[model samples]
Target: MSIHLFNKRTALMLTLAATLTACGSDNDDNMTEPPPPQPEPMEYSYDITVVNLTHEQPLSPITAVLHADGKMWDIGMSSSIALEKLAEGGDNTDFISQESVIANASAQGPLMPGLSETLTITTTDELATHLTMVSMLVNTNDAFSGLTNLELSTLDVDATMSWHLAVYDAGTEANTEAMGTIPGPADGGTGYSMIRDDVDRVSMHSGVVSQDDGLMSSVLTQAHRFDNPSIKLTITRTK
Candidate 1:
């Protein structure tokens, strides 16, 4: 081939290679790594502490729940089977599993008098703005202590709230304090009975009427008696 023809062909080949390289560079520059994966939703967490304040009454395993705006129980209303179970028997399985609950944490065991326990619950549900806690005074027939439908939306992270809880009666059973009716160690007897013998509604507890109080049929004694504000509860938002 002639030198002039060969040189012109070489220059054309180099120009084409340069153009392809430039196009590749432009494509790379226009390309973007997919946006950093969006972060997961933030988690909200809370810690609950419960202290048993009675002299002889043992608080049942606590059922701490975070729920929507509804309550688990209302005074003057009929007690739910779940509440009845917790109050009369110190069993919280049904109470924590209620439909309104968004998140829940249960104490590992009963809180004895003068003792305390702490449980932690976490959730991402923004609708879980209310808190409910329930535990029984096991020495009585149907006595319980708790606070229900407490608003927690305004409780900031690291903030704390507390309450001295009063006792309530499930009223599902008569306060007989009989040999086979008291559920605690004082009797080790029956816990729950489907029979609604007493007032079926909830109300403030009138405290236990022990044998020392002249109830001759009662198994409970002076030590088994209790007063209002039988429990102290504190809640802290961790996140």
Candidate 2:
């Protein structure tokens, strides 16, 4: 009888131990954690080359933006205040800060006519497929050039794309080319003002009618006159 009782007790103890072991194993599983999720990888990179194509116009420090489809400025549309400042003063601060930019870059200084400079940009997303570059013709009143809303998806790695940009009038001010109204080395005049003295929409810049071209009040000379394709822009994917 004692043997029988001992066997029964031992069996009960074994079952209890098995039950506890099973519970402990489940607890361990509950406490264990899964690995963290990984982030999506990005693609594509670019190297932009801007060649100042004008004869004497000193281009402002160039600005390049990487974003989705859309332009930084448009003809017939009112310009952004950022563009206004850039056109008037050659200031790139606000232009660089404009929203919708996935990535951007700027030249260290002005790209003198007949000269060239390069700016580079990288993106984590190849989906970022549009490009815009802008700079002012420093010797004129609100004359700016660069490509806008250009599609970049078709450009392949190590490949290059180019454009001959045209000058546009921001229409924020008159092309008086008058003294103290023009910025850049020619006059080093006022860059920006609160006055909206010209047509409020952008349009093809009537090539500068400098002091030599009959705008007697013009502070600019014949050397400052310019035309379309004032600059050559090349964008290459480096990585």
Candidate 3:
């Protein structure tokens, strides 16, 4: 009888131990927590259209940028090498790579007179609240047209703004319009020279005086001449 009672007590103890072990296992299984939340996404986008209004000059491929806050070209300030490059050769390589440029886009090829090109620039950074657009009148010497540091923060999605951009002299070259001096089809001449030959300050371009207009050495004709408001620029926020 004592043996029987000992067997029953041992069975009960074994069952209790097994139950506690199973409970501990269940507790461990329940301790797993859920994953943390993810951050929200952000995006901003803009569509820019530039129309070449010149009678004959084909604009260099357009360069448009969305930045935080800074002027690429300010009147009375000397032109950056990048600006000079673009103004002279229509090469935007250095201009688009500016440190202040948050996002940028460019036209595929020359923007011919009476033609328009539209490009879209997008960024995940909402801080890019300034827009700049630049292009060279390929038929002249250091003549460029564009808008700079125009405020974009208040522009709502789908909203639009427009500007008739005036031409500006890059001030890095002379406007002699001489043979082998212009970079366009008229001469296909040298584009940029490091020497600061002209008035070394940014200023409104006193329109190009072609060969027909009395600049005797000019390779260009009256058809290449241009005045203020050379480009019709329109900007629309897309996102």
Candidate 4:
């Protein structure tokens, strides 16, 4: 009877030990930790600065866009209605809202003659590889200046690229420069007339023939006339 009692106690001790070991193994599995967190994707950014190089023509609110494809304006092609709206009235709302635009920005107000404006644009999207900028010459009829479809992919971060921009005629309106046709403070005239009365094509602008030069009907004087390279643009990749 004593030996049987001793054997029963031994069996109970072994079973308890096995059960405790199994429970410990299960607890270790449950206590395992998760992996570490991941870092966020890097953002691509740029700083764009525009300096009005003209003597008198105040630049309209500048419109800057980062896009993948398509152009804001072409030398030979007819200007889009959106472009016309901008070149004619200094309104950039439709130009920057186009479908091809990935990211866009605009200056708060007109950049005065000999003044400068800076704008920053950023995106995580790798597809936004092209840049375009447009702004009208408020003192001229349908005259605009800026870059179009400029490639940004090759530009390295922290590097800068700059160019002197020439004026371009939207050709959507005649360069009459009449009393009520010019917009700026010079005339306080009508901004946009959708008559399509010009050459109907885009071309490099012929410097204004202000009244000081001839064009007796022109509301502008010699101070309002500008030559090639009307604006200076500098672009820097920040990230």
Candidate 5:
């Protein structure tokens, strides 16, 4: 072969190789990476309503809680200090701050007789599958009413459940209905006391013995008395 021909052929081959390499580089530069995957957010919500059915007994501020499967209180069991505080004094700060609580809501103030209040609670926790509600019968000593450990996992969106709650004695204080021991507007007396002077265990409350009922020392009258199913509670799933 002649030198000139061979040199020409070699130049053409080198040019083809360079063109191919350039095309490949251009393809790489024009390519784009896919966007990062996004995560889905989760939320759950509920609304709780409490109605006072008493004639004159004012209901204390209501505490509504959502938590995992567990009972806050049981009959025949001693009351926790948190429950004691709420039952005796209408203080729910400790009950709402419990470690097991996933979310909580409270009423602004005491609920007057024949009145109702609604509270809403929301949470992102998937483990929260139970509900509890509590409030005191402010006219009596250590008297409270509510439901506990109510299963919520089966509750559907926009669905509701209702109950007529009965009163329970915290067994932390005596129901003297005396001049200085009752906490309601009927007496404006002290609320909670650490002293466990009563049975020291939770049980169904025996209705109050008011001054009209022959208890002379009692500060409460027939007007301050209440019976079972003192409050009507309703729960709805909003989300």
Candidate 6:
């Protein structure tokens, strides 16, 4: 057959398939004829702003992932090994590439205390409807800040959404704020360890009890301590 005839035949088959899938829905009733082939999916873009509100803790480079179905982290569960790397070492490369994510972005440097940073992610899938933001509070051990399973459907394009996010204890490492365990400016010590300590499951951070607050083994002073909602996150659907 001629190329034009073959093309027409292929388009006719696709239209038939789509009509069958619609199964007499209202959409099918309206489609009396086949429409032109669709282009690739449109991209959805968003800007995520993270403000570090701690007294002295510096946030590691922010990790933002866009997925269709689920959260990257959850409370009362042991973190994934990828999460352990990000939580303990401020490395998001592995976490964002985890199979759970469809699209991802990360900030370049630490968001210092009282400072802010913005990370942007774009997805071509309309199925991408959930957001998860993650970053480490690098002055301590296994303490990280961010949100999981933040539904983004109700938010309209060009509208802004904000949240005061809480911190979490990644149950991969011990919270011993000793002299050489922290990996931030406060300690410049080691990052990931194979040992599992503390409650072996994720939970709300109890806030740091530094040396000044009577954790005798904690090398951190009052300056290294922090409370809830350490990060102010504002998300705007840019496109």
lDDT of each: 0.90, 0.86, 0.91, 0.90, 0.91, 0.87
Off by over 4 Å in 4: 1-39
* Local error of candidate 3 at residue 112 (angstroms): 0.4
Give the range of the ten consecutive residues with the poorest summed lDDT in model 6: 25-34
Off by over 4 Å in 1: 1-36
lDDT of model 5, residue 187: 88
As a whole number from 0 to 100, the lDDT of residue 163 in candidate 4 is: 97
Error of 2 at 237 (Å): 1.5
For model 2 the TM-score comes to: 0.82
Q: After superposition, how far is residue 78 of candidate 1 from its true place, in Å?
A: 0.3
Task: Kindly report which residue stretches of model 2 are placed more than 4 angstroms away from their true locations once superposed.
Answer: 1-40
Per-model TM-score on C-alpha atoms: 0.84, 0.82, 0.84, 0.83, 0.84, 0.82
lDDT of 2: 0.86
> For residues 29-132, what per-residue lDDT tens digits would candidate 5 score against the true structure?
76444355767657888899989999988988989999999899999999999999999989999999989998999998999998999999899888888999
Tens digits of per-residue lDDT, candidate 1, 57-113, equal: 989998889998987788899999999989999998888888888899998888999
Model 4, residue 58: C-alpha shift (Å):
0.4
The residue pairs in collision within model 1 are none
* Structure candidate 2, residue pairs in collision: 42-124, 43-124
Q: Between prediction 1 and prediction 2, which has the larger TM-score?
A: 1
lDDT of 4 by residue, 1-239 (tens): 99999999999999987887688778796643435577787788889999999999999998899998777778888999899989988989888898898999888999998899899988888789899988999999899999998898889999999999999999999999999987888899988888899888999998799998889999999999899898899999999
RMSD in Å for all candidates = 10.9, 9.9, 11.2, 11.1, 11.0, 9.7
Worst 10 residues of 3 by lDDT: 29-38
